[model samples]
Target: MARFGSARFTTVQPGVKINNQPRPAPRTRAGGSLVAFAASAVVLLLLLIFILQNGQRTDVHFFGAQGQLPMGVALLLAAVFGVLLVTIQATMRRIIQLRLLTGRRRTPYTSTITRPDPADADPGADVPEGRKS
Candidate 1:
């Protein structure tokens, strides 16, 4: 066999589309995550700007605790505490639900899976050692 001086390479064909129609690109988890991250970053930037703009200091009093904090910071803290309370409540509810589920699983009446007693199992029914039916 002799080699040709000019080499021709075959082009890779693109994938065939369904019904020969053009379809939009599919959404990807990374793409969605990137968008969410960008949105969160923008929100954080806006919050930062808001906090900076409201630079006035205010007195904060809570259950015998007194402190001075920026007005924006105080409001942000209040919102954070409120969110924490809801999170705690939801967490407690989930914990209680899990506990109840576990308790129910342990209860004899609630359990559906049953096993035969080992003592009730017969070694032989048709014949026995040194004996025949």
Candidate 2:
């Protein structure tokens, strides 16, 4: 990890270029954030292009409702609604499980572990096998 001509780390090793500072550490969080940001930007750009390209309005009808929406927007709304439905269903399932768990009677905790007998403290002592030995 030595860098050329840095006098600070000359004593660290023999006749090679010495680097005073420690080796650079990878910035995982920053790099991850940057990658995520780039991905998000790309996705946003693509979405914008898709919306612009599908600007033509189309009639939309849903359970006693009617409206006009751009194709891209309508599709996006449908996808969002689908995700919401799944999320709500999962939430309800978890709630039901929690309620069931709460309603059930739980056995009171009992310690099966008892203190070691003072007689059994010395391993070298000759003794009969005790129940919990």
Candidate 3:
């Protein structure tokens, strides 16, 4: 068997060569980055407003007593969380696409299909003679 790596497959039967090019992939535009940017900006804006109103005295805790962190640190953490969320969504979408490409046979819908059955026919059929029942 000959391997064509990334190239499209072509079949040769007898003296005739047939070019069976693979169908084009579907196009998509992910808004993960845009969402991440928007979320981070909103969080930062809110944090700025909070700092202006509350005078930047935030108590950041981890495992009970990890000491208080500055408001800047807390705002940075919120931005990181937004980025992680976007990354997770993008990763899930890629996994789903890979699964769709590698798994299950696709059966397309058809309006009508021809059936081959002689015994399964109308009993009282109207037709010109010469033709056998």
Best by TM-score: 1
Question: Model 3, residue 41: what's the lDDT?
Answer: 100
RMSD of each: 7.0, 11.8, 18.3
Q: Over the stretch 1-133, how does candidate 1's per-residue lDDT look in tens digits?
A: 4467757666876656778875556899999999999999999999899899888999999999999999889988998999999999999999999999999888466658889787887757546676853
Most lDDT-accurate candidate: 1
TM-score of 1: 0.65
Candidate 1 residues lying further than 4 Å off, grouped into runs, are 1-21, 109-133
Using lDDT as the measure, name the better of candidate 2 and candidate 3. Answer: 2
Give me the runs in candidate 3 sitting further than 4 Å from their true place: 1-55, 62-66, 105-133
Clashes of 3: 0
- Candidate 2 stretches with Cα past 4 Å from truth are 1-24, 98-105, 108-133
TM-score rank order: 1, 2, 3
Clashing pairs in 3: none
lDDT of 1 at 65: 100
lDDT of 1 at 38: 100
User: lDDT (CA) for every model shown?
Assistant: 0.87, 0.84, 0.73
Worst 10 residues of 1 by lDDT: 124-133
Worst 10 residues of 2 by lDDT: 9-18
Task: Report lDDT (Cα) of residue 27, candidate 3.
Answer: 46
User: Candidate 3 residues 16-67, lDDT tens each?
Assistant: 3347654454444556677788999998798777756655658877568666
